[model samples]
Target: MDDVAGIFARESPYLERYVQLGIASGRVLSVSFPDAPDEDAEVDHELLDRIFDYLSGVEDDFSDVEIALTVPTDQRRALDRVREIPYGDQINVETLARMTSGIDHTDEDDLNTVRTALDQNPAPLLIPDHRVRDGPSAAPPAIEQKLRSLEGL
Candidate 1:
């Protein structure tokens, strides 16, 4: 399990996204989008099975899992705020920025700052960065829409 982490992917005519999970010491260490595998992810079959099972339902939330955010100091607070967003709920970037303002002194306007932090989020599904949006900041727009649709948002 140390050498091999589970990789899970889902696709539909309207949406496609890949989720890679690296676990160490029972905690999720790293999560990112890797190039799609050419073949099935059969190396870590059991882990991928569980992840796929959880993803099958729209209401399933990963908040119970411990996720690490190894991001820049300036972006850490904003990312944390994103994690607090309850499942099935979405918030505007302006609101997220205002909530994270106390983290550091910066120009009062935090829309750009918050958007930048979220744009660079490494763990999209785990952190639910798609919930933080004003207009089209959500990457791979179709996937974001699909995630929201799944959550019934």
Candidate 2:
């Protein structure tokens, strides 16, 4: 099983990208996003346990699946907030490195720092990007041909 475990915040967006790439490559088996509530708020152990129970339900399907977590660079406060939680300990640098690798055209120094941090602490943090990419259009001629055919019909 190539599954990765990380905080929900860090893993969500990267999961989206990984799923997209998996769909493109036809290698994705399944994806998991374990829910984590705000830690600074009052703790509801029962609710948290229930969430874990739900995650356990799907654990079998992803027996051999690769797990990835999304870590946001902007949520330092959130990371600090969850430091006491059990899953919080699982947050590490490898997950962050994987997430960083997904980012397009990042500076080498920044990437290296993130890698080094992962090496040192081995925790994942979430980094969200509001920027959008305007990727190239797919199947342009096919789309045009379909439009022309409809007009002719």
Candidate 3:
């Protein structure tokens, strides 16, 4: 298994905040809110810039940034649909469950699958899990709301 062997931190567009990324094999594996910047960690300048851009309301949907996720097949399917949600747009959980799981109607089990997939999203901003209305993400509520506000949602 690949471990998060690289760490990078940068000043976030969010006031008085810094964002840290855990990277491995040239793909970002996680994002976190840290109180201070790390000057010693290796830097992936390009990816950090993209994250800053996204936080700055630059309107890039993060399609260019690569993220690594390990999840069950059902969860992967739901996340794939979540990734396609554009910046500043939102989708209801019911609709997303149908679109991703291919259920003819809104089923509780399917909705739970989508919810669980979102709740377990390893990378939030890169995957845009918050774009799904009432969607749960690993990101803190403040951060998710901040991201949504940044996107003008």
Candidate 4:
């Protein structure tokens, strides 16, 4: 997974780990959007185009590729606000809705909002469940002793 931000590739610690694992295991291509707001009306067509271009270049390495979009919980309200916008030719409402509502899995309000967005845009959106990585197997004895001493203070 290559993270392209504003037409330039960027580094993300979390994505680096994920991509490293995926590439090593020869898993399907999975691209994620970690910090993009849900209601971002302009879908960053340039970024998407670049991503697709990159994907096309790598088509031979992986047989299948998928896109995963992540949005913060706070961005739902912004999506609601987007619905009220005039949404001139500058934006694609369907794509915006799909990207925004892709990972909404909270309560009735969120579900309804997601449903509405999906109803408006029936494309399948990838929503990844947050997975916690296991920490180090064991700490050095000296480090453990230091931690124990600190706990007693």
Candidate 5:
């Protein structure tokens, strides 16, 4: 597997934040925070539409949208668990660690591993890392909070 940091640095460009009225279920897809440099970058119309719909209200489902997030193989299980987190709910690190404990055939989902998986999550809303929090140290805290507020949770 590739190094997580290297993957993030290389794949940063593809990560986009966009919103479309009737396109993506009124959801927003962003790689970073609104104020980040990549915020104003151009994105595909279809993708924006999907993001809009996904973030809209209750009809957002991105199972059809194909996205690639590169991380260590061990983290895949935890990331999948992160994605499984409901749109309007959040989970703490300990809980996530417990949930994903046996996924990798070992206790690889310790606190630090889970934290790294979340912090390096390439797709935020798609994976919904904002829903996982353990205090001010959660990955992408500001963006996570914004997403949670958007969901009215």
Candidate 6:
């Protein structure tokens, strides 16, 4: 665990752990809660401030934060719906499936599709995968729950 403990670690005074972010081409590619703080993120200074604001419990408009995702149309649709979820509000997997696929009721296939999309999400917080209850995300489950608790409308 010591060797690769901080592949995605970012130093923050607000918390004991790290909040690492990956950025490229004016878009955040990834965010992760690694076990420790290691390398410093090198990206836009503005985005760094925004991330710090978020870490400090400020409900900044993450909707405007740019993110990159190269996925199929269906996955993009699911991620788009995830972005629309209210800051503090949470939706169920079944509901997300319905919202994305427009099925009368949610089935395993629809739910799985949504799950796959969420799991494949390159950008979690910007896309707000934590806003979806039981939704899969690249962020750790603990971090997802913590984000849900911290963010408010």
Overall lDDT per candidate, in order of appearance: 0.62, 0.27, 0.77, 0.29, 0.54, 0.70
Regions of candidate 5 where Cα sits further than 4 Å from its true position? 1-30, 34-43, 101-109, 135-140
lDDT of 5 by residue, 7-42 (tens): 111112222332211112233323444433333344
lDDT ranking from best candidate downward: 3, 6, 1, 5, 4, 2
TM-score of each: 0.69, 0.20, 0.85, 0.18, 0.63, 0.78
Score residue 104 of candidate 2 by CA lDDT: 27
Q: Please report how far candidate 5 places residue 46 from its true position, in Å.
A: 1.6
Runs of candidate 1 with Cα error greater than 4 angstroms are 1-17, 23-35, 38-54, 101-109, 135-139
Per-residue lDDT of model 4, residues 1-153, tens digit only: 344322222332322311111111222123333343323223433334433443333212111333221344434432343333321112333333344544444454654554443333211111111100111102222332322232231
TM-score (C-alpha, index-matched) for candidate 1: 0.69
Off by over 4 Å in 2: 1-44, 58-104, 116-153
Order of the predicted models by TM-score, top scorer first: 3, 6, 1, 5, 2, 4
Candidate 4, residue 69: lDDT: 19
After superposition, the stretches of candidate 3 with alpha carbons farther than 4 Å from their true spots are 1-5, 13-15, 36-40, 102-105
RMSD of 3: 3.2
- 1-153 in candidate 1: lDDT tens per residue? 434444434333334556555664555665554446425543354444545654566354566666556777657788788888887788887677667846433565455567677887766777788776563433466667776776777
Which residue pairs in candidate 1 have backbone atoms (N, alpha carbon, C) closer than 3 angstroms, thus clashing? none
Clashing pairs in 6: none
Give the range of the ten consecutive residues with the poorest summed lDDT in model 6. 1-10
For candidate 5, the 10 contiguous residues with the lowest summed lDDT are 1-10
Q: Which stretches of candidate 6 lie over 4 Å from their true place?
A: 1-9, 13-15, 36-40, 101-105
* Total backbone clashes of candidate 5, pairs 3 or more residues apart or in separate chains: 18
- Indicate which candidate wins on lDDT: 3
| Candidate 4 wrong stretches, greater than 4 Å | 1-49, 57-106, 117-153
Give the per-residue lDDT of model 6 (tens digit) for 72-141: 7777888988888876688888788778755433477767778888988887778888888787876777
Residue 111 displacement in candidate 6 (angstroms): 1.2
